[model samples]
Structure formats: structure tokens, C-alpha cells
Target chain A: MRHILRETWSGLKRNRAMAFAVMVTMWVSLSLFGVSVLVAEQVDVMKGRWYDKIEISVFLCTKVHGGATDLSANTCEPGQETTPAQRELIQTRLEANPDVQEVLYESKGERFADFQEAYKNSPIKDTFTAEDMQDSFRIKLKDPEQYEGVMNEAVTLPGVQAVQDLHQVLDPLFAALNALVWGARGLAALLIFAAAVQIANTIKLSAFTRRKELGIMRLVGASNSYITLPFVLESLAAAVGAIICSGLTVAALVKFVVIDRAKPFIDTLAWIGWDAAWVAILWIAVTGVALGVIPPLLSTRRYLNV
Target chain B: MITFDDVTAVYPGQPQPALHRVNAEIEKGEFVFLIGSSGSGKSTFMRLIRHEQRPTSGKVYVAGKVLSNLRQWKVPEFRRQIGTVFQDFRLLPGKTVFENVAFAMQVLGKRTSEIKEAVPEVLELVGLTGLEGRRPDEMSGGEQQRVAIARAIINRPKILLADEPTGNLDPATSVGIMRLLDRINRRGATVVMATHDANVVDQMRRRVIELVQGELVRDQQRGVYGAE
Candidate 1:
């Protein structure tokens, strides 16, 4: 062990600059991977928490001759009006369902009020008045998986015309975010792999340049492990240095870049915060070691040519 | 004792075998000169003893271990028992003379005290006792070669293989290096040196094994360098 360490120490000291260069390269590459993985995980967690709380919206039919009828004129009989009593019945039924976690009743006037606030300056806001909207029951299910069951039950209700899960409503937004996350992960992996290869090649070339010295060591009775240990250790040392730098960079980006820029949105978001910092830290450290070990193992094996 | 039983070596990317059907043996404490012109397989023979290249079709037994049949892991252990020096005086350029000599023992995992004890003793034997702290660049060619010798013998190997040890030195310096190797041989370590220097070889009057065009041409006890 001492022999191996002595060899490692000598090698590192001999090419201190090259070692440092390799390390810096590893740090930047690995930091990008670490940060991206953490952000994706955090995004997933946010999706889980928020999607669990989302409500399923059930649109009520129009009232006709003391009964409910489909709101669209094309689907409705001659004269139909969606009544308050029909909406009340639907809301009560949704509230009593086994899968229903809660039910929120929204009257046409309330829907109009929300719409006016949602699109205050839009031209379409004045075109459709509060009375033109259908009364709806927003039902929160116990789990997101129960959404289909709840939607089926809701659409079959006496006064219901249609039911929609909000995820389907926000599908475009979720899809865009998911695509961004996966794209970032793919890009990060590619860059990190390139960096690892770069590091391996650099170390390999260094070994080749010093083949004469290594041959001398061998002729002079230096053990095989002793000759190999320095190259391995040099790679590891550079990796460690790079990993540390990458970790710090990741932490800094998370703190100053992501969190700072997203502060307003994050503050209003009910359940996202710094709880993922430890997980990020763990990922960074693991990435550093893996990046350090894998390439060196390959490069040294080739360098040894045994 | 080292013996070659009809050993032949063919290196890759070469047109022909470097050594061909060579048979010889050197008993313990024998100081022998391996004489040949360049490309006459002198270096190849040296490498075979060190197991750098295995014999293509025959056996090479060094101190009872067959070099051709040795496994990869056993190679380093095998080399540790046989010291080797090269023509270029392969000293670590960045290391001090003491460190270079101490390195041999260090690789064998000898304790610090053992290194502290052994390195100085070997340096004294090589006549580089006071130049221990100097790097290779700071020393003369002869001094660097002495450092290489000290490194080779520090582990107290049973056999010392010198491939053109004085090929790059002046006659005076070459004689000095030869005498040091001779002294080590006298102390019971077998010395096998490959050289073309007729003056040193003739003066030593040791056993000689000569090779020509990859074949053994002569083997003479009390041999002269150019006796062919």
C-alpha cells in the first residue's frame, strides 16, 4: 500500500499541471450532470405533490321542464335550461361518492367572476356573460389514479354533461416541462461521457509519453502494482478535484440561478423548497467518484497493457 | 542459475525471429558477457530472462522458474529477484539519486527503515555515496549510470542483467562501471552483460556467449570479446 501510494504521489507531483487540468474538466462536466439530475427529480416531486391535489371538473347539463338536458343546442331538445336544483343534486352526489375526496360547487356567476379575473383585458370576456356558463362540480379524488373512475361516475350523473381531469387540461404544460427535463438529462449525460473520455485520453497520452520511465522502473525491479498505482491515483485525484468543483458549482447554480430566478413562482407554489438539497449533494458526490473511477480504470488498464 | 533450453523469440511486426534455437546456461555467481552486433538478439535474450518477451518455442529457466511458462501476476515477482540496468542509465529524471535507488526497495514494499539502510549501502557500492541528493540532470553520465546501478542492486537481486551498460560511457567511466558490476558478481550475484566493447570484455576475461544473425556462434570459458 505504501509503495503504491509513494508511486501515486510521485506521479502527481511530476505532472501537477496536467492533473489540475483534467480535474477542472471533470468538475464542469459532472456538475452539469449533477445539477440537471437534481432539477429533474425536484420537478417530478413537484408534479407528484401538485397533481395529487388537483380537482376533476364536471360540467352540468342545462335544465329543461324540471329536468337536466345537454347544454349544447345541437344536443338539447327544443327548449332547455340548466337549473340550480340540477346543479345542487350533482354536487351532492359527487360529495357522497366513495372516491371523492371533496367537492367544490361553482355557480355560473362565480365562473364568470373567475373568468373575468383570469382574462380581464381579453375581448372574449365581454362576449360570454356569467349566465351563458354552465354550473359545474369540481371533484377532488383521493388519488390521481382514481381520476378515471371519478370522471366516469361524474359524466353519468343525472345533471352532468362532461367531466375532465385537470392534467388533461394542463397536458401541454406538463409535456413541455417533461421534454425539457429529459432533454437536459440526455445532454448532460452526453457531455459527461465526452469529458470522461477526454480525461482518459489525456492520462493515456501522459503515460505513453513517459513509457521510457516506466520501462526503466520495470527493469529496475519495480512491482507491477507499484507501476500502475501512480496512474490510477493520478486519475482519481484529478477526478476528486473535479467532482468537488462541480458540486460547488451545482450548489451555487441551485442557490443563485434556479432558486433565485424561480423565487416568486416557488413562493406561490405550495410545496417546493430546499428539501432536495441533501439529495442533490449525494448525487454530486456519487457522480464525482464514478466519473473519477470508471475512466481511470479503463485508461490505466490500457496504459498497463498487461 | 539461468539456462536457455533451445530458446527462440519472435517479436511481433518483425520479419524474422530475433533469437533462434539458442542453448546455454550460467551457474550461480558466473560473470558472463553476451556479445553481438546490433540486431543480433542480445537485447532480446536479456528481455527473455526478465520475461519481457516469452520464448516462442522453448524454455528459459531463471533461478528454477521457467520464464516461458510464468503467469502475468508472477512476472513482477520474478523481475524483482533479477535486477536489470540499461544502456541509457534509466534514472528517473526528476528524482534525486537516493530516491531513484530507494524506489526499487519501495516497490517491493520494504519498510522505510529498510530503505534508509539499504539505499545508502547500495549507493556506496556504486561509488555515488555523496551524490545521493543530486538529480540525474545534475550528475555526469557516469554518475547517473552509477545511480542506475545502485537502483538495480538495492533489492539485492540474485542475478543482474546489464544490456549494454557501458554503451554510452567513456572508456574510463565504462571500466569503472564494469568493475562495480564485477564486484557485485563476486559478492555471489550472477551478472549477465550484453556488450560489444572489446576492450572491457577482453580485460575481464569472463565466460562469453556470442551471437551472430540470431544464432549462437560461440560459447567460451575465460572468453575474449572479439575471439570469433
Candidate 2:
């Protein structure tokens, strides 16, 4: 074992150029793999934050239970105004539901004030009044995903103007993010394959150069593993270098880009912690090492017959 | 000890066998010379004993292990009991003579103290006492072959197979290598040398096996180089 260790270190020194080339190749490949992992991680964090904030917005009435213009198929029927008693009864029912958490009542005057505040700098603020604003109840649920039940119960209520869901708006954004994560993962798989092949190529090259010594070792009764260790260790050294590099790069990405940029969102809840970043780094490093190792085990067994 | 029971080797896709129904044996501590011209299966004869090429028919027994019956993974363990030297003196060019000699023990997973004690002894036995730090390329052909001998014998193998160990050396150096092999054989390692060197074979006064066209034509007890 000592001899194998000595040989492994010496072999790295003897084949430093190939070792460096392999390290550089693995770094690039593992970095891509790390980025894919981080991207997936960041997407999960964003989804969690946005999903919690998602609410079923029950728009009550602007003109009445029915309006003048036909909005859509799910639009509230055209009638007189939504009665105050009916609105209060609907609010009470929403608050009583176990799925509902907190129901916020927004009158037309409140909605108009919010609009003016949102568009405070725009000249368009002068064009709209509280009459143009619709009154609605923003219903926060215990679990945001159980929104279908809320929509069904609220839409048929007497005072409901129409039901709107922020979840619908957030779905497309989440869908695009999920797509991006899957795309990165697919590309990462390709990069990992390329990295594995490059590792095998590097080992083959090292074996070719050391053919004479290898034959001597064989003649001296060296076991297949004894001969194989040096090649394995050389590639493993490259892998270790790649792992540290990728880990640091990934940590930096999570710190500066994901956690920092999404600070405001993450502040509301525990989205991405250091534990998640650390876990992601470890996961990628282990994967990189495995990819670097399996190739030499295969190629050497085939090419060198050891 | 080594024995061949009608061993024959026909390489893949070859019309003729390299060795044809050739039977021979040599006991422990004996020195023997294998003499033949080129293509007379002398090299193939050495390879058979090392399990480098298995017999297409029959068996080869080396120190009680059958070459044909030996598992592929255990071939190294079988070769461990035997030492091998070559015509080109296959020493690692990048390593010093000390490292080359130490490698023989290193592969066996011998302890450092054991290797430290054994390597110098073998180097001295092979007359390479002062050349431990020199690389093969820095040495002469004879010195390089001496390093090869040092490596082969460092592990104290029971049988030593030398295929033209002195082939590339001049007459004087060839005799020197033969004397070294003679000394190694005297120390209880069975030495089998293959050569067409009439002078070295005539001088050794050892048992001789002669082959012609893959057939064992002569097995002479206490033989010289040839009939002449």
C-alpha cells in the first residue's frame, strides 16, 4: 500500500502535463454541472416563496352582481350592485373555511388609493377615480395550492364580481423556470459524459507512454490493482481539484446571485439556507468524483487489460 | 522446478503451433540453457513458462501450479514465484537503478524496512553496488542489463527465466552476465537462460535443451554449445 501510494504520487509528477489538462477539462465540465445544480436549487427556492404568497382574489362588485359589458364566460352575471349584506355574508363564509387563513377586505376607495400610490409618478394617476376601482377580498389560504376549492366556493357567491388567482400569473413563471432547470440538467448530463470520456483518454495516454514500465511491473508479478492505482490516482487528483473548484464556484453563485439577489423574497421565509448550498456543493462534488473515477476503471480494464 | 507435458501453442488464426508436443522438465537449483536460432520457438518457450502464452494443448507445471489451469487473475501470483529478464533489459527509463530494483519488492507489498534491506543486497549481488542512483539511459547496455537482473532477483524468486539476458552485450559483457546468472543459480534459484551464444553455453557446463522448428531435438545432460 505504501508502494502504491509512492508510485501514485510519482506518477502524477511524471505526467504533470496530462494531469493539468485533465484538471482543466474536469473543471469546465464540473462547473457546468454545478451551475445546473444551483439553477435547480434557486428555482426551488423561488417557487416556495412565490407559492406561499399566492392568493385567491375574490373580486366582489364594481357596478353590481351583473355589469354592462360581457367580460368572459366565467364573468359575474349582469345585475344591479352587490348588496352590502351579501358581501358581509360571503366574507364571513371565507373566514370560516378551514382552508382560508386571512381574508383582507379592499373597498373601492381602498383599491383606488392603492392604485394612485402605485402610479404616484405617472400622469395617468389623474385619469382614474375610486368609482373605476373594483372592491375585492384577498383571501390567503393555509396552503396556497388548495386554490381550486376556494375558486369553486367563491365564484358562485351572490356578491362575487369575478374570481382571480395570482397563482395563474405565477404558474407561467414557475413553468419557465422548471423548463430552464430541466434544460440545464440535460446539458449537464452531456458535459459529464464528455468529462468521463476525457478522463479515460487521459488514462489511455498515460498508459501508452508507460507501456515499458507496465510490462516490467507485470513481469515482476505486480497485481492488476497495483498497476492500476497510479492511473486511478492521477485522474482522481484531477477530480479532486475539479470538485473544490466547482464547489467554491457554486457557493459563490448561491451567495452572490441566488441568496443575495433574492434577499427580499427569502427574508419573508426560510427559502435558501446555507444548508441547501452546502448540500448542493457536496452533491456536485461527489458526482464529479464518481464521473472522474468510473472511466479509468473501465478504460484501463479494457485498454491495458489490467 | 518446471515441467512441460506435451505443451503445444497455436496462436489465434495461425496454421502451425509454436511448440509441438514438446515435453521437458528441470528441478530446483538447476541451471539450464535453451539454445536455438531465431524463430526456433526459444522466446515462445520462455513465454510458456511465464504463463504469458497458454498452451493450446496439454499442460505446463511450474512449482506445482498448472499454467493452463491457473485463473487469469491469479497469473500474477504465479509469476510472482518466478523471475523474468529480457533481451532489451526492460528497466523503467524514468527510474533510477535503486527504484528499479525496489520496484520488484514494491509490487509484492513488502514493507519499507524489508525493501531497504533487500534492494542493496540484490544490487551488490548483481555487481551494481555503486550505480544505484543512475538511470538506465545514463548507463551502458551491460549495466542496464545488470539493473534488469537486479530487479528480477530482488524478490528471491524460486525460478529465474532469462530470455537473451546478454543478447545485446559484447562477448566480454555476455560472459559477465552469464557468471552473474551462474552465481544466482548457485544461490538456489533455478536459472533457465535462452540463447544462441555458443561461447557462453559452452562455458556454463549446464544442462542444455535445443529446439529446431518448434520441436525439441536435443536434451543433453552436462552439454556444451552444440554437437560440434
Candidate 3:
């Protein structure tokens, strides 16, 4: 072990420039990967936090009688009054559904009031007065999974117009985030592959430079395994150095940037536990060992000749 | 302790064998010179003993082991028992003279305690004690050759093969290298030096083997370096 260390140290010193280059390559690639994965994780946390409190908006329609051009729209359609009795009956039916955790009834006037507050200064505000809006039920479900069942039942009601699931509203954002994660992973893979090739080339040149020395060593009773141990250790040292640089960079990023800024959202998601830190460490450590070892095994093939 | 029994070596993409029908024997402590003109098989025969190239036919044995049957894993061990010094002085430019010599012991995984003691001792044996810290480029042609010699014998190998060890040096430097080989041989290691330097070859008056083309033309005891 000591001999291997000595040999590895000498090799690293002899090719200090190459060692630094590999270090920087590893640092940059892993750093980029670290930040990207953390960002995706944070976005997921935010999604989870927002999903729990969000409600589904289900719109209902009134009967069309004498078409008064829908004037006094705040009032029910002409001869199509939805009396208190009719409203109570709809409420009773919704409350009886198994998936319905809670149902809140909001009249068109209330929706219009909420809209007025939501879009206070928009020009479209003038076009959409409360009277032009539909009366709706704001529904909550026992489980997020039951949303589709509840939505399907609500939309088929006699006066219902639409049942909007809030999760669907966030689907596009989640999909975009998923795509970003995959894209980052792909780019990281390409860069790591290039780094491996670079490492192999570096080892090849190292072998070429020491061919005669290797020949002499072989002659002087050094076993093939003994001679190979040094080169393998050297390659691994460079790779491990790169890995350490990358791992530290990743851990630091997670600590200083990701956790610090996303704490509010992260705290809201209970399942996204602190075990993520351990996983990151293990992943980076494994990546480092892999980067260090694989190239040496391959490059040793060519160097074994001389 | 080396013998060649009709050994022949044929290189790829060549019209003729590099070494053909060669037979010779050297005792354990013999000092022999392999002399020939350019394109002769002097270097090829040296390579055969070192197991750098196997004989294409017949048998080649070193220290009682049939080299032809030795596995690849055993080649390094075989080589370690024999020392080879090239004409080019292939000292690693980055290492100091001491480190270069110590590298031989290091690769053998010798203890650091052993290396520290052995390196300086060998450097001193080659008349390079105080110059241990200098890189190869910092030394003269003669000095670098001496360091190469020091490296060769660092492990106290059984045989030492020097192929044109002084090819790049002046006559004075070449003579100095010859004396070093002589000193090593006196320490009980067999020495096989391949050279074109007739002066050094004739002056040594040791056993001389001559090669012409791919054949052994002469093998003489107490020989002179001439065509007689």
C-alpha cells in the first residue's frame, strides 16, 4: 500500500498539469449536475406544497328560457330561476358522494366578487363582471387519487359545465421540470464520457513516456502485477482527486444554494427527507471511484505490451 | 548461466530471420562481448536472453529456465533477474539520478528503508555519489551512462546486458563505461555487452562472439577484435 501510494504520488506530481485539468473537469461537471438536480428537487417540493391546499373548481350552468339576451345576468336565466330548493337539492347530491371530502357552494355573485378582486386593474375586468360568470362548486377530495372520479361525477350533473382539476393546471410545469432533469442528466453523461476518454489518453501518454523505465523495471525482477499496480493506482488517484473535488463542490452547492433558498418549500414536503444528503454523497463518491478505475483498467491493456 | 541451442528469431514483415541457428553457452561469472557490424544479430541475441523476444525455433534457456515456455506473467520476474542497459541511456528526464536508480528497487516493492540505503550505495559504485540529485539532462553523456549502469545493477541482478552502452560517448567515456562493466562482472554477475567499438573489445581480451548477417561467425576465448 505504501509503495502504491508513493508511486501514485510521483505520477501525480510528474503530470501535475494533467491532474489539475482532470480535477477542473470533474469539478465543473459535477457542480453543474448537482445544481440541476437540486433545482428539480426544489420545484418538486413546491409542487407538493401547493398541491395539498389547491381545490378543484367545478362550474354549473342555468337553464335557458326566454333569451333576454342574457341581460340582468346576475339574475337567473328568464323563467329559469334556480330557486333555493333547487340549489339545496344539488348540494345534497354532492354531499352524498363517497369521494367528496367537502363541498363549498359559491354563487355567480360571489365568483364575480372574487374575480373583481383578483383582476382589479385589467381591461378584461370590464368585460367580465360577476354577472357574466358561472356559479361553481369548489370541491376537495379525500385523496388526490379520487380527483378524477369526483370530477367525472360532477361534470355529468344536469347543470354542470366543467370540473377543473387543479393538478392538471400544474401538469405542464411538472412536465417541463421533468424534461429539464433528463436533459441535464444527458449532458452530464456526455461530459463524463469525454472525461473518461481524456483520462485514457493521459494514461496512454504516461505509459509511452515510461516505456523504457517499465522495460528496465521488468528486467529487475518486478512482477507484472507489481508494475501494473503503480499505474492503476496513479490513474485512480487522479480520478479520486477529481471525485473529491466534485463531491465537495456538490455538497457545498446543496448546502449554500439549494437548501438555503428552498427551505420554505422543502419544509412543506414531509416525504422529501434529509436522507437526500446521504444519497448525494454516495452518488458522488461512487461516481469518483468509477471515473478513477475504469480508465486505468482499459489503458493498462496497451501499456502492458512494453 | 545462459545457453542458446540452435535458436532462431524471425520478426514479422521481414524477409529473413533476425537470429538464425545460434548456439552458445556462458558460465555464471563470464564476461563476454558480442561484436558485429551494423545489421548483424548481436542485439537480437541480447534480446533473446532478456526474454524481450522469444526464439522462433529451437531452445533458449537462461538460469536453467526454458524461456520459450515461460508465461507472460513470468517474463518480468525473468527480466528482473537480468539487467539491461540500452545505448540511449533511457533515464526518465523527470527523475533525479538517485530516484532513477531507486526506481528499480521501488518497482520490486522493496521497502523504503532498503531503497534509501541501496540507492546511494549503487550511485557511489558508479562514481556518482554526490550527483544523486541531478536530473539526466544535467549530467554529461558519460555521467548519464554511469547512472544507467547504476540503475542496472541496483537490484544485484544475475546477468547484465549492455547494448552499445557507450555508443554516444567519446573514446575516453566509452572506456570508462567498459571499466564499469568490468567492475560489475568481477562482482560475479555475467556480463554480455554488444558493441561495435573494436578498441574496447580488443583491449578487454575477454571471450568474444562475432555475428555476421544472422549467423555466429566466430566465438573466441581471450579474443582480439579483428576479422582473423
Per candidate, the number of residue pairs that clash is 3, 5, 4
lDDT of 3 by residue, B1-228 (tens): 999999888899998888889999999999998988988998889888888777899898899999889988777777778888888998889899988888888887788899999988888889997998999999999999999899889888899999999888999998888898999999999999899888898889999999998899899998988966
Could you tell me which residue pairs clash in candidate 3?
A219-B79, A219-B80, A220-B80, A221-B80
Q: Candidate 2's error at A237, in angstroms?
A: 3.0
Candidate 3 docking band: acceptable
lDDT tens digits by residue: candidate 1, A230-271? 777788888877777776776776677657776666675533
Whose lDDT is higher: candidate 1's or candidate 3's?
1
Maximum-lDDT candidate: 2
Q: Pick the TM-score winner.
A: 1
> Which candidate number has the best DockQ?
2
Can you list the residue pairs that collide in candidate 2?
Answer: A60-A161, A64-A81, A66-A77, A66-A78, A66-A79
In order of lDDT, best first, we have 2, 1, 3
Against the true structure, what is each candidate's TM-score? 0.81, 0.80, 0.68
What's the TM-score of candidate 1 when only chain A is evaluated? 0.78
lDDT of 1 by residue, B1-228 (tens): 999999988888987889999999999999999999999999889888887778888899999988767887777777878888888887778789988888777766789998898888888888887888899999888888888888888888999999899989999999999899999999999999999899999999999999998899999999998775
| Candidate 2 docking classification | medium
Better of 1 and 2 by lDDT: 2
Off by over 4 Å in 2: A1-6, A57-163, A258-273, A302-306, B131-140, B202-206, B215-220, B223-228
